[model samples]
Target: MRFDQELIASMVAPNSRVLDIGCGDGSLIGHLSQEKGCDAQGLELDMKAVTQSVAHGLPVMHGDADAMLADYPDDTFDYVVLQRTLQAVEHPRDVLRHMLRIGRSALVSFPNFGHWRLRWHLLRTGRMPMTSVWPTPWYETANIHPCTIYDFFALCEEDGYEVCRWMVVNGNRQSRLAGCSPHLANLFGEQGLFLLRRRTR
Candidate 1:
């Protein structure tokens, strides 16, 4: 597991209920159930992923995240996770708002398309990025909308969502100290996990 995985895992208490949106192949859900004893359920759009989840004895529903968010009642789960899925959906902000309403907290993680390497590729080669992180031809990529690290925070601020914790993972960032090295944070913070709560104000 990477730092994002550790951050996501740390968000939920032991035996806490969780609902994972766009849960690919039920990997984390399986881990949470077997290792942490979490009560986990998953919502996935892909048939192959859903079938794989079911075969693993995981509670999974093949459904759209945008539509399915309205089905769950308020405060149904301790945590609602949107792992690497915000870009794929039509209305990410609406989804996040509803997720917070339906669960105590929400975790959102996305591949940062605004990484400097991606920027360099676009600027230098004038070609759509085809890297290890986002390995897809422009026409075939499932990513409808791409985003940056600060962009996500800006949305959270605009929509009155409180950021409980934000972890920018290069490999496994375990340091207590941080720096204002703008180049390092931007260039290296490839993936991030943002833990959010409803803003009371």
Candidate 2:
């Protein structure tokens, strides 16, 4: 599992039902089912990844997050997870709405576009920044809506979603700024992970 997947797995309760969106190769799904005792399933757009996961005896289906998420009835799973796929989705807000509607909570992780390194690189080179995380060139990348930590918070607020928990991590090391304000996290964090729920009246 990737670093974000580990953190997401830690957040999910044992024996809960989970739906992992864009679940590449079903690594997290396997981990969640075998280790956490959760009923984990996955939806992936890549046919090759779907085949690989199915070959491993994992319950993963080929599906698109933007189109297929709305087909599920409300609260069908305990959790809906979208790891590192938010920016690539066509309608991120709609995807998030569907996710929260179909599950008790949502787990989201994405690269932070407001990281200082990116800012510095853009300022220094006056071109699209390339790093280990955002390595793809602008013309070739699927990330149409790169966003910051503060931007995510604003979106959650606008949609009446409660941020249950959030953290910032770089590589394998968790940033101390995760406990601090979003300003700090936005400036320093490489990626942001958030656990969110609908704001109940």
Candidate 3:
């Protein structure tokens, strides 16, 4: 399993239901079901990935995150997870809202655009920055709405979502940065992971 997937799985409670959105190859769900004893399933947009997941005896459905999320009833799962795919989605705000509506909590992880390396690269080159986390060329990348950690916090505050937990990790070092201020995290962290819930009135 990927480092981010392991972190997401750790956040989930044992034996709880989980829906993994954009679950490529269903690896996370498979691990969750077998290791954590959870009722885990996946919804993937890629047909090849869906086929591969099903072939592995995983319960994965071919579906789009933006369109298919609303089909689920309220509180249908314990967690709705979208990892490394938030920036690629067309309607991120709506997708997050729906995820929270259908699950008690949501886990989100994305590459941090405001890392100092990206900022320095852009300033030095006066061009679109490319790094290990953002390996694609600008023209070919699917990240239409790249955002920073601060931007995500702002969105959560604006939308009345309670940030239950958050952490930043460096993919190269495989080290986590927790209990740090958001400003520091935004500058140094390569990726951000958050667990959130709808704020109670």
lDDT (tens digit, per residue) of candidate 2 on 1-201: 787789999999999999999999899999999999999999999999999999999999999999999999999999999999999999999999999999999999999999999999999999999999898999999998999999999999999999999999899978885548898999999999999999996
Candidate 1: where are CA atoms >4 Å away? 1-3, 171-184
Displacement of the residue 57 alpha carbon in candidate 3, Å: 1.2
What lDDT would each prediction earn against the true structure? 0.82, 0.95, 0.92
Which residues of candidate 3, in runs, are more than 4 Å off?
172-179
Ordered list by TM-score, greatest first? 2, 3, 1
Of candidate 1, the 10-residue stretch with the lowest lDDT total is: 174-183
Residue 135 CA error for candidate 2 (Å)?
0.5
Superposed on all Cα atoms, the candidates' RMSDs to the truth, in angstroms, are: 2.4, 0.9, 1.2
Between candidates 2 and 3, name the one with more favorable lDDT.
2
Compose the digit string of candidate 3's lDDT tens values, residues 9-108. Answer: 9999999999999999899999999999999999999999999999999999999898999999999999999999999999999999999999999999
lDDT of 2 at 66: 93
| Clashing residue pairs found in predicted model 1 | none
lDDT of 1 at 120: 95
